[model samples]
Target: MAHIKSRKHPAARRLNCSAAVALAFIALPGAIHAQQTKPASAKAATEATLPEVNVQGQAQSYKSDQVSSPKFTQPLVDTPQTISIIKKEVFQEQGATTLTDALRNTPGVTMLIGEGGNSSARGNISMRGFDTAGSIFVDGMRDLGNFPRDIYNTEQIEVIKGPSGSEYGRGAPSGTVNMSSKTPFAGNLNAGSLSAGTDKQKRATVDLNRKLNESSAFRINAMAQDSGIPGRDVAKNKGWALAPSFAFGLNTPTRIFLNLEHIEQRNRPDFGVPTVGLPGYYNAALAAKGIVPPSKVNPKNFYGSTSDFENVNGDMVTARIEHDIRPGTILRNTTRIAKVQHEWMATAPSGAVSDGSGSAAVARPDPNTWTANRSRQTKWQKNELITNQTNLTTEFKTGSIAHTLSTGVEFIYEKQLSKTIAGAGTMSPANLWNPNPSDPISGYALTPNGAQSKGDTMTVSLYAFDTLKLSEQWQLSGGVRFDRYSTENNNVMVDGVRTRLKSSDTLAGWKLGALYKPASNGSIYASVSTSQQPPGGSNFTLSATDTNINNPNLEPQKATNVEVGTKWDVLDNKLAVTAAVYRSENTNDLTTRGADPGQIIQYGKKRVSGVELGVVGNITNQWAVSAGLAKMNTKVVAGSATQTGSSLNWSPELTFTAWTTYKLASGLTIGGGARYVDGMVRSVSNTANAATTNMLNVPSYWVYDAVASYNVNQNLALRLNLYNLFDKEYVASLNNNGNRYTPGGARAALLTANLKF
Candidate 1:
């Protein structure tokens, strides 16, 4: 949990690729491009117009070579980092609907329930041993909400690994997740899908694109879904979304785009099953009473009353303009405004229940007659974001060296408002063993106490990047970014008193990379990058306590990463193979290891090192595949192992995922994939340190999924997906306290008819 304030470390003070192996390999035809040394007729003018990084298209439908962000300025094979790019086609083939479903194609990522005292952060997650819910982005701009994101309008997803402050502003040390929206393309096309499956699942999606003229196009995407958990009772997910975009002067030197999206959701929230007889259950009070731990409750049990609900709304608008200054030079500007609103109410079980009076420590000897201590979570909040960005990309040669450069400036304004609520209001406890939704003594209503809080932030950032082709086989790339920002917080506490807090700071970050092309389609590379997190950077709320990490007076946390890797495109450029080894070190964590309680120090440090391997694209013209594996170790190198933030609390030692499909040339295709997550210890360090929790670990698990499709005609197809093919019972996610868990889905099936014209 340490943050390095400077861009350079002691040994790293001196420094900083093959074609990348991380993401699917498509191609980026625009932006900074490398200039060719050959004759002008040999893609020369375009080379000078292209960035130093490059790629070829066709053959492999499962691979993409470049990211949506122009900041990269190079193809994945040449970039020295661990990245995962998932295209809509991949997930669509698997019948995936939500962001969570799509992310299963990668390794080193895990889900999270909320902390002990907070409600669940529905779509929250942990990656590479750090919380990353706050680092989600869309089309290069930050998405402020933690709500579950739908992929109906998305073209592809990019999972950028390691600290990446040079690419984005203040962010999670673990990395960032970015989604690229589907936009207008030439030609008239209409596509849609209708699906039905287990748990009464029903869903539909539509995508339409029209070319009005040679210079204009229009597109729209829409989706609706209603589904229920296979094993859990009284839990369901229902939502709808629409995204529309228009483009003008697409083939001209100047082009403009207007886009917007809106989504609505209503769902039944599940707090999860209790942990009494699970692994590592040791309760002193119960043991002293000569009572043994009772049998674990069924994973299908639902603790919340039937009245529980979660409602959410998300909206976004974007405007973009792009101009070609010259054959190889392009300038672009983009602006966006977005907002998300969330409200929820749910019930959770704590321990043994007491008389309606709510007394303390009530333990019942009769396991069957025991009652659960019911607690309610109610929330109402809104998150807003506004941002503008401008960039210039151009390629040129200086002597024998060719260069692709990109520079940009950005402005952002973000806001959050929260309403405080207290008290469960006449709600009664449910039976410990089997709770009934109808057995409620309800006199309950959504009521907000006289308390509220708001946070606002304004920021401006400037950045520049350049990729240099030193020779036919050597390349160097680097970038630097500076961000200036200010934040303010206002609160109206329960006491009817108001308090105001403010913070201002500047953050500087950068990265360097070097690549040596062993072959035209392959490379070996190395890279170093840094990320910074200022006070209140994640939530935008400064704290009054000097010892708190969010205190305005505290220094920004800094994280540095070092990585080495190789990438190769083989079998006539149809298949890609990649491997990398990396170490991310965060220094200067705030801790009172040897100091007084109120006086914190910044000498603590934590580190996560790992190896990653990936393969994507077609093994043969008729066969496509994608797969990844990650192995990591997290440790509190220089702090109290049990201290919060000193080490990762939910990092798994190993994770693996894989998928493949083959077309039989008879209009039929078959594919299947597997996912494995190693046991996640709830302790700070990877060492043998026991965390303070009844459930010390979430056991490792494996899940398999299968898919098959038939192309009935040129514009029609039928696809079927089988999830949890073996119906293996396991834990999907666990809360911070480890006393509750979300169970993995039971075996289920989904059928869909795809249409296009």
Candidate 2:
């Protein structure tokens, strides 16, 4: 078993933490002095005064001149056990177009680049030892699908680690990511950007907010992009998105909002990268033998073509209503409806095959020989989800006790339908692989003709929570929840047979927590939480050629998580730092055990321990930075033996990211950062063959990105971004099919312009 040992001493750790706090203390006074001394520039004066939009229910800090602070990002921090927020400014500076682009550099997340390549279906992002599995939310509303996420409507990204049963129902033991929308403001304003770079990359985005009245407003945002292969021949991504929003406020005590978003994407796929044994190792040995393997292999020929296909469309509608019942008491209700559809297909390399006699070592490129070739696979899915969440929160003072109580009931209904069609190199007579390079690869099917698997899922939950102030400096919080779920799979028969079944289950979860606020701006906390996941339909099997893998006799994957953390704002709020230590165990773990080449049984038990550290603040008025580090050790304590000690697929043991921005002048900013992930393994198999063992363990890699922007005026700006700055080559995920996976290309750049009119 390989484990990472922490070498820092107790006292040293404490001192480093103290230094961060001291630095924050020094920034407060300096910032105040700067605000009082610097005269307003003409550019700042040219922008009109706009109504404030406070995300945290605060007012004063919502104005144009102030930067969002810990106070403004507190709601999530206070409600969830662990939370992290990535601001809009950071996204713009990074030119993030996908969730992986935004999360790859996050401390606790490592995105799995699937063997299917760049144009293949989007892969998964692991957080705290569990997969995201299409479990994501927009404006605090649940939406599940395999669709890739684009950054057009994103205002901010927030990640909450650990069981979220109190809010999100029946999710993985890991965590969830929430995306906030760009809201409407009472003013005439605009912001947009444009860029063109490598791989023939081009992009444009525009945002507009208008006021309908003192109590009503509307907002619209649009994005478009066109790009080509930045690396291998078969990879490409192109898409566009449009989002419109509206909000109304009858008075100070009541307000309501509605949002509608739509997106469309067309992608050219690239999945596998041929492995040319890296530089020093293979060459030296081969040279000594007076024989050398080619530096690179194309893995394709005139008669063997590789390509990817993609088409995606989605829509979402969300609404929120809130009423201030009294001084600190409020009543709120939120609801959302969403739909998503996707169709994707791609071709990738399959490992070498030996002849029947076992003596033939000749290069096998023809489909008829069965030596080496690419397999074509296709997957399509459609999803619909609707959630209605209502809560009543009351904060009141009774004698010496201050209490904030929140009671809520949430119900969510989700349904998904999907089909997969897969075929090998030799299928039909017309699609036969040409043995000769001079022949054309025509009359062949780019996508295989296969079978379809369908299913429907439903989940219902109810929960309640309360926060009690025990003393001036101490508080206690606790919550409990109950859930019910079920799934039914309808199979499409091959020869006229009913091969399907259904299953359901009920579960409960709870959390207990305590906090000590030594000062108004610092908090030390400890919490114990529990979560549950319904029996997924794919866990069972009933036959050989036909599996009765419908939802049947399956149990929920459950876990208990214990965590300790602290949040401190030093230097009078100029610097903020957060650190945590956590241990989690899954009693009835969910895992897969292969029954055949393309089939598996899913079930198990697992345990994990980890630590996290983060810092976000201004080093000085002219400089700002945010950085984080995370390390975890996860083991299948009790489960299918094959997966016991293997590094969990996308969950890397060590992950780190950092960003720094330096203000060059009155209105100019430049910043750059890097994301690092220690190598990882994606799968576990029973055999010792190279394809089965090595395909699961992918090596480590690093990515670098940079940005530069200038304010033309208070309401307008220009910017440029360079991504994959060095074009580092690496693969994201691999499987036993003898196919190696490869991520997208490198060394690309883009330019953008934003205007507020």
Candidate 3:
């Protein structure tokens, strides 16, 4: 008896009730694979075909064979660097929510938009070319501020790449981004989901787990979202999140885990769209002499200030413990505490003028009322962050060599309060070739002209790491870290005169690596690392000149990286490929001072050289794939030749990504993907300013996405997602002198209903 056929519709008798619990989980996995291939009778196949039990969990992939990093405990094809992982069912089948949509499945990762026009929930990525939003992390700790990140209790994200300074400590010479929460197991799982599409999207998510007794356990995850940001205009986004977890002695051997998290956000800020006569211009011979250019706006225009606003709040607490003290030795501990808050009010755009016989270019609101210019400005900010971390891990062996160890200590506290109000008012810029958004001008006000700045910081760090095998295909690893930082700053004026500054520093970082396997799924590696930063390395402010950070001849800003890599685990291991070639350098940097004129020196130097390729998991078993590629070359050999050979402002010298999925036997599943970048450089180079030349580019683009699912039973499921499928409008982010720009989100659709019990 084997009959399983069902595909009826009339809206499946008007679904609802959570699509009838997602059609019984899309019909219980095709009715349990048709009752395990029916024909197995013959008295149950003459009994006894048993005696083949091989269960070694964790291996179900769309890429991600293994990763639970606290700085590699092996398996990621044998980790030596260049990690990626995405999981969480590939951003829940691509209806991704935040973390820049799961970093678009990685390829030289990117995202930058938040030049303080506020609210993308902070964390403005841009890896490999630096600016790693302070290297992110959560679970592995450090999740400072700049808000906006939710993957509804994410269960995987990784990243890792270059430098990583001995596994974190003043990172970002291009690397870092962890995330990995979602715990409590001993299962009895419960899941939930609901979503709606288009610019008026709405979302809800929940995941609950329980199992009290026989070891103890509990888990909870929640999220809520309200959206709108298709073609921009009045851009909007709202958020909510909560996470709770607890576990005690699960599976015994002494264990404990606890977690708590809360997040909130309110947004309405999109300071994008405008780049004077666009299209790669480095003053194209001053636009062939006639100038002109500035008219086809409408990527859903909405030039700020409709009561601009952005607010975010976050909190976290974590604790972990493990103990075995025998049988292969084990002991682990983790601790975390976090707090964050941010506030904002923004309205920006100020550049563009030229309109007398050079034909056009008008953005006037006041430059004496039109020497041909456009204007708008308003800024206000507040930020606070607190962090703490503790770690210890262990493993042991001697004699035949084998070791794995980790030790950590960290603490950080940061505070910032800022306000900027210049010339107090200006608005009314339209007509760079016909414009009018109800043109009106005046010194628009949002208050806060109190000019103030306050900054505070404190940090303490100590770290150590080790790994070694030394046989059966050798292995070795190393790490070291130490830090001591301090800062205080205050500046206020608007007639309330005040100024203060202080600084302190101490730093060191290191790493080294080697590995070789040859077989057993292949591996080959080489590595070197170093990192350092001081002088308020990225905010925590400090300046009273003398070369900043309260001078004393300030110093610290060094980097070095050298890499070589390879990893393979073809078919039988279910895919997993990797490759790398690298060179990274910084050597101080902090130019100027070619003999005073504001003094500052650091013998400059910059370099980047790259090649990377990756692939992940399943090539069969219903197919699944993940892909990446990157190519790079950046230089500045000595420094200041207007950036010597250019290449660093949002660096992008090629990138690529790919994703795949397939499954069917009636339980349906489908997928598609694409992403490409290449075309960057829009600032940082001052050959005395020829508009910072290198042709001021940004171009290069490609995007595409699609997904489908059905499951109808076993617990219900249904999904559909599509994004920028064909409406590639381009320009996803830009800032750093090329006057704003953002764009990039034009086609959208989403529909989901999932339920599991």
* lDDT of candidate 2 over 218-282, digit per residue (tens): 89999998876565443567899999999899455898988898999888655554343322212
Query: After aligning candidate 2 to the native by TM-score, how far in Å is the CA of 116 from where it should be?
Result: 9.9
TM-score of each: 0.90, 0.80, 0.32
Lowest summed lDDT across 10 adjacent residues in model 1 is found at 9-18
Which of the predicted structures, 1 or 3, would earn the higher TM-score when compared with the native? 1
lDDT of 1: 0.80
The full ranking of all candidates by TM-score, starting with the best, is 1, 2, 3
Worst 10 residues of 3 by lDDT: 6-15
Compared with the true structure, all predictions reach lDDT values of: 0.80, 0.61, 0.69
Judging by lDDT against the true structure, name the best candidate. Answer: 1
Query: How close to the true structure is residue 311 of candidate 1, measured as C-alpha lDDT?
Result: 88
Q: How accurate is candidate 3 locally (lDDT)?
A: 0.69
**Best candidate according to TM-score:** 1
lDDT of 1 by residue, 1-757 (tens): 3222222223001000112423333231111013223332454466567775333222237888899998888888788788899988799998888888898898999988775222364577789988888888899899886777889999999999999899898988899999999999778989999999988889999999999999999999999988887788789989999999999998899999999999999988888877766665544445545677667778788887788888889999999999999988899999999999988888776545222222223345778776666677788789999999999999999999999999999999999988876654545666778877666645576678989889999999999999999987899999999999999989899989998999898899899999988556677899999999988888877777755777776778889999998887666456778888999988767754643333356676778998888888887777899888887888777775346434467788788888999887686888899998888777564344232225667888889999988889879999999999999988888876666778888899999999998
